[model samples]
Target chain A: MAEPAYLVASDSETTGEEKSSSPFPDIAIGIDIGTSQCSVAVWSGSQVELVRNTRNQKLMRSYVTFKDEIPAGGVSNQLAHEYEMLSGAAIFNMKRLIGRVDTDPVVHASKSLPFLVQTLNIGVRPFIAALVKNMWRSTTPEEVLAIFLVELRAMAEVQLKRPVRNVVLTIPVSFSRFQITRIERACAMAGLQVLRLMPEPTAVALLYAQQQQQSVHENMGSGSEKIALIFNMGAGFCDVAVTATAGGVSQIKALAGTALGGEDILLNMMRHLLPDMDTHFSTRGIDEIRRMGLLRVATQDAIHKLSSQSSVQIDVDLGNGRKISKALGREEFEDVNWEIFEKCESLIKQCLHDAKVEVEDISDVILVGGCSNIPKLRNIITGVCKREIYNGINPLEAAVRGAALEGAVASGVNDPFGSLDLLTIQATPLSIGVRADGNSFVPIIHQNTTMPVRRDVIFTTVHDNQAEALIIVYEGDEKAMEKNHLLGYFKITGIPPALKGVPEINVCMDIDASNVLRVFAGVVMPGVQNPAGPVMEVRMPTVDDGHGWCAEALNRTYGSTLDLVTVQKKGAH
Target chain B: MYSNGVGHLPRSDPLRFSFLHSTRLENPPQFVSFRIRPGPAIRSSLNDTISERPAMSFYELLGIPETGSLVEIKQAYKQLARKYHPDVSPPGRAEEYTQAFIRVQEAYETLSDPRRRALYDRDMAKGVHLAFTARRRGIFDEQMEEKSEWKSRWQSQLSELKRKSMQKDSDDNMSWGARMRRERNQSS
Candidate 1:
């Protein structure tokens, strides 16, 4: 019970190398979690606050319910109405079903989710459930997010009276790296200590780099450069970063996430108001989960009154004789979520074309979460960031207030009028790779690179005494290897036989500065010492959840005899 | 297991959590094995950068000249990023002025950008990246089939352009009176 923030961040790196005893511990905190609301925050000695639960409600509703067998969560249950939160015993989107996989088409469109998801599309882990009182109750999205991070660590250790272990959460830049290893195994099963997961628009560009370092202490010029661009759009991710900041750091420079959001605009307006909503709510009975919890609480109250009215008249009936009368205006709910707002303008034009940032050198175009309150996603992100957007924060507490200002700047918290001397700089939102040429996806850490990095590539063996290889480790940036996102695989097995493209392997990859992810590999062969095998690391993505049919059952139980490739170099990238 | 994709469930307490102290109980849904001490199995790109002669030439790390402008490389990178602003420097010289203020802001972000200072002025006039392999293969068609704009063709491309202009003056550690007036106009 005493993992005291890794014994106070390794005893402040062995006896205070003081910048106020480093490794961040102003009781760190800041959570977010959302795919349907969850909060928490901290640094309260003089700012970032949030933490409200005794139903004073500072967001909550992310879910746990199980109607008694001791389940509860969404921070101390408290769920009273909205059809007992679309009943069938509660369990909400555990952030779009955590580290996904029932052959994930977002877990087969969360099979008309009124809970009890099921999906046996073969690649595994998607049975979910909650339907309690009429029997069904299973669980695991890492035990409903470690039971909502143990009620957000006992409501931030009863409001900072201390001992609430590190944290800083806020993910989704299209997660993957085995959904950040099941959100760090649901924050080490709530004995919490994640210290920094970040990337929800780099925690809103670390709260726009502490609001441009408190507007650079009331306008001091010389340090120019702001750039921003954020655009979050919540309820299960839709990122897009582009940072740049300066002085109080914030780098990022280009992300472009997309597990599209507001749960695909409430499952595309509940399949445009039940056009036989998946054969009348696919069935777990109990009257089709109470007529799919009354048309998902009348389509979440006609999409929250079509965000300040323009026409909404859902009129559901489903008491087992389906009946939906529609009217949903706002240009027919923007023609039923216009391909999720034309995929939020190609994820803000591919994050300003991978941060060669343009839209007139953006300065601010922020827009945080909860589908950044619609108006056709604020006139298509203010007409593709031709600026005028910055809804001045609070789009559902701007990603846990930029993850509680990156939990007071990576917990080395300071700010003697210098605004928490910060430093964000992260990026690599997917593109880790490794699945040789013929199999394809070879990337080796490419996407938006930066982040506590360290790379390595050189691959080889492809047959002839391939002796043994199978390294697997994927994570999307597409281009085959079965369209990316695997994240773990090993099996080196003494390869001294050499030949085919003759050994040399290498691999490496690092990532640390706490976005964890190790990998390693190693193999050699020329004048071989301990090469041809003995070095297999693998910490990534702690692989799980039908790693796409375990990379098709390890390529049908080792097919191309442990393949490997990309050692290409005629001027490599 | 959802029909074999190892989507990791077969749980009933497969030792649920204990990730980072480098758990070596090997394999399960639980992992946190740090390891990584095995350093030298030999590598080279020479111990990856920070102490290599490879850096230094963003116009001599911003002392700026070869036609510097973007307003003199943003006023010489805002006076060397305000004399290396690691929180206004001087607190135990803020990590050696934040690693020379992040290589003087990565040489003022590659010389205040006009297409990354025209590709860092053609990789500082060919210290060998032949215009970065024709700007990363947007094809220079092997720089017009290997150098010669017909300047009296090749004496082996004039000793490979006099050893790439003396390896771009020892990688811009500078000794250039315009490379001694192009080696006395290629020795008259």
Candidate 2:
């Protein structure tokens, strides 16, 4: 069956085995699983076309409803009305909560959902469930996402008349290596082998590169460099990227992203509607779940209506003589969600700064995502970029289209018209480093460095005669080690007890074409032709679930005995 | 884009020349070593390129003159990138194309940055040639043990890089005016 084939493909691909030797390589479909909506697109011989489901829906709702013994997903499930999704049986917005620990503020804020999200406030996965048969059925975000992806795969297969195994999924830029592993695991569960995970904004940049290449062809120009700034804000995350395109190659200069999106806006509006909503809905009774569902549906409707209207009248009723009737103006909605908008502005600014691009040099500003329709966000992005939004691509379908283009390219599909002659040189979205110099993060590969890149940093032991040194790798721009995400940790033994700052411990980080990260470390002393010991190459994100407390545990057990500091280089100066 | 195949060997042609030359000097027997095997066609093609050019400057690798501007550099980079990028290249020559593409990218990276370009210019003026960091291939492809052996041959190359960086640090120690004067003198 296709399920077993998927497991074998994923396992081999994860082991970095080359699968391109087959004469007819399978074309990986591109899937954009948005927080609230999802779409599938494939390169169909001549052009990218969205794969519609049996219901002829191009964009399906992203949710999985637990009913009876089997679960139904949005891809094939028929919902009677919008309120049915909010009835506590549906699990949606798994993208935001997939890899987050229970102590995260995002998880804490998710408690107000109609479904049950119980957090112990410890550094562990949150407990989530869906209402079934008047009882709570335990579930996880990964399980719900896998069920949804399985439905998507089945639908695409039925329409395309082929087994869909490989997929290029679009993920947010803010996702850590651990989150990416979770995404890969979900795809594995769905019997899908992930070929690539393109960041949302970078995918848009690829689409823009194609558009620019086409224009250059029409004009018979030299295909000069065109600098474009992409701002993408979806239902669950916001991302920005600066790219330079020429000759069908989009070189990503920098990327910035944050986990702030439309859900936060809806929650804030819900709070405004009923001040005591959290306390009133704290109890997980059936009546409160129904009331919460009503409020969620009402607020979602108002938010959507406010996109085109000046004011939206929101009225909802709860049991026990509780009611909310309020007028939500566009200005009021914008004011309430000012933090989200502010974050969007800062992400664009930070991306521009990191790219070393000036506003005057930006040829086009591309805004593509679900939230691109928000007037306030549009203004903020345009104001910062000082350019009007590029209108050549669809806001919702841009990412999936780009992913389809990437799928074809990575699959080695050749085209006569040169439409497939495209490449996106990606950049590292976050710094991957190790803890050194007394708990400070020392980045071996800094953020915004180009991909297929390898960089190394030399370090020395902090304690004299220290035989072993711990290499606790983290990913972020944080200066303090605790603030960053701990990817994994390893120990370099047999360092040949030398002075505190004598031996050179080389820590190298490499991100290859497929976005696989491997960390190599060895002890290299001056005047030594060979390393002290055999080098160790470890694939990253080696830590498993509930890894949030590993860093604290490492510090507690070893203290400062195995710490390393950056090696100081001396010269004639 | 890149309909012509002229730039396929535009960059790696000259660098591969120096690489084979250094290999011949450092460890000539390694090419025939049983552990390291290249196909006869690859060996012959590599030998042919050895006589093409002995060494290459970053500017020469990109097919641009030393005085090329940032725009010209970017154009050359884009052209070569389109020709040799792994995804765009024909499937039969992905391995060869990827190596050339990395050289072009590295050349563009060093030349596009003003500070790095100046340092490279200084090194070139002082007759300190830049050796290809062969470790990149070894570190990436585990199946290719030849790369690791090739990396050991370039250990002295790393020391050269270290010395160049030390010179750069001493040059950086000067104040803005002094450094500008030194740069002007070097250029002159």
Candidate 3:
């Protein structure tokens, strides 16, 4: 009898010996686990080596399809065909689900993407459920990501012939502390130690700066100044960052990113072209187009052609003798995806505004990521920003290369990562204070001050014989604390009862280096010796684990047989 | 709101006016006066309290040149504050350090504000000339009371010391300092 598909193989040979003498692994991996496509790159001792999937492909379509039910013995044998046959069931663009609520605008926007998503109701907790196959079900974004990470890890392990452990994952600049923690936890569950969770634009800027350094050395003797604006247009997001360097200090002056990017533009173009097809046939007739996979292939082809050619004929292979073809020009593509182009332009302008600089101030503009290959996007950014864009390096691979350089720098190896001189960009609310009686927060710390600073406010008791006071902490510039998000609250107790106006209490709010806030209070009595005071400590909230979901997932996947082998080895010893 | 509440206070009791309400007083506390000893004279006001004092000019408090730029003034204040911040220093001395630091900070802030600094510069010109004449005559009004207080206090202390010395001479073999020096030499 065949073992269960979910069962861990008992006699599976563990490859690669643990070498204690080796200081560190020669290879470092950078995994860009994106929504539409997942790409993995491994940096060997020297250059980055792209690891292909089991099917020998550099990138995998982030789609998992499931069958209605298995036919008899099992569905594993028929899963591949079913994946293709029931393409409607295939859930793509999982990145949109990561760290988002069901009511989030991005979740609604994901409807435009070509995929099937199910909303699961688990008690009061509403989560996204993606059916990967008859036997596999992903109920959360982390689980879906774990499946992709596992595949990427296996690919790296096979290619390098060594155990790959350290990885650098890229996240959006706007990711909250909780979101970053969740991604970190998911990576940890997949047996990968995340060295750092770097912002995508920062990684791209580092990569571009590294390339510029190499060119400056090779062509110009030295001392040549170079500044670049990295416009990263990925499948699910677009972000722009301005990087400037003089001497050895590099700074990311500003960054702007949004949830709209290349995939949105393509979908918009698809909607435009598909409706035009309805002129020749009924809307329901497109069902045949979907079944034949012509719609998927045609849409992708048109996007590819638009990158290089002014116009290309999208031919729909009807599988029968009949065929349909339509010519899509650059003008038509721009008209169809004008909204996306406008968003990209607005983000670029926002970045420039935040930096308080002009386009002329930037020496070079580097276009990066797979979506950046779109000619229309490239032209729009260049024309609007009024700077010449550089496409000398592959945008798809730039972030990974930069991540590898970062890994090399972390491992104490000599590399170009240092020459890049990337600056860390952080965005947090400017002012923090507490609420008063009339729903007003007495402003304690003003915004725009470089952090790791503290400010104190002194308040007297309002009522006579009062012993305790509440310090309600809030984030935002709102005058009222109730209007802002209550970060945390602490009560200062054990104060000696005295006349209302006589007792004094000093509340100190300190924002630490990590942008986490801490509150400390001091209470004093009129004539008491060594009056009792209370100190309340509140840490930032981390991602919540709903009763060991990751641990159980790991056990179901890699537990039983491995444990037996370990037991047997111990017995033999 | 205020007119109706005037009669509420008892006539015999002193009606207290907070910093926010009253601008003038029958007699305000002298800010420049300090209790002097043989060592450095310590200011009576706490650091946070000096902000309420209106008599002292900003330039005199910060000890900075009139022509100092904003950056220079800020740097000087930060340096002085780090040196004198109560948290890092000896416990009891913090009150004095905090007072001086706050006065210095207030001076920097006043001078940094364009309008305030302009008014201050004019007032400073007249004040400096008066102070110079007062100093030359050896009749500095600010120091007169302080000097007299120090003199009278020291004289009384001196008499008490003489009486103690006379009593000690009959009983002890050496002076206190001499005996301490001898003990140190023996220990070494």
Model 2 docking tier (incorrect/acceptable/medium/high): incorrect
> What is the alpha-carbon RMSD of candidate 2 to the true structure?
12.9
* Candidate number achieving the greatest DockQ relative to the actual structure: 2
**Fnat (0 to 1) per candidate:** 0.00, 0.08, 0.00
Each prediction's Cα lDDT score?
Answer: 0.67, 0.76, 0.51
Against the hidden reference, what TM-scores do the models get?
0.33, 0.82, 0.57
lDDT value, residue A208 of candidate 2:
94
Where does model 2 exceed 4 Å of error? A1-25, A571-573, B1-54, B88-100, B131-188
What C-alpha lDDT does candidate 3 achieve relative to the native structure? 0.51
Best by lDDT: 2
Once superposed on the true structure, which residue ranges of model 1 sit more than 4 Å away at CA?
A: A1-56, A64-93, A100-123, A138-174, A177-198, A224-244, A247-250, A253-426, A437-443, A447-473, A476-545, A556-558, A568-573, B1-123, B126-188
lDDT of 3 by residue, A355-428 (tens): 65677777778887778778777788789768777767677777766676555443334334344233232233
**Superposed Cα deviation of residue A538, candidate 2 (Å):** 0.8
Per-residue CA lDDT of model 2 for A205-275, tens digit only, reads 99899989888888998778999999888888999999999978899999999888888888998898888
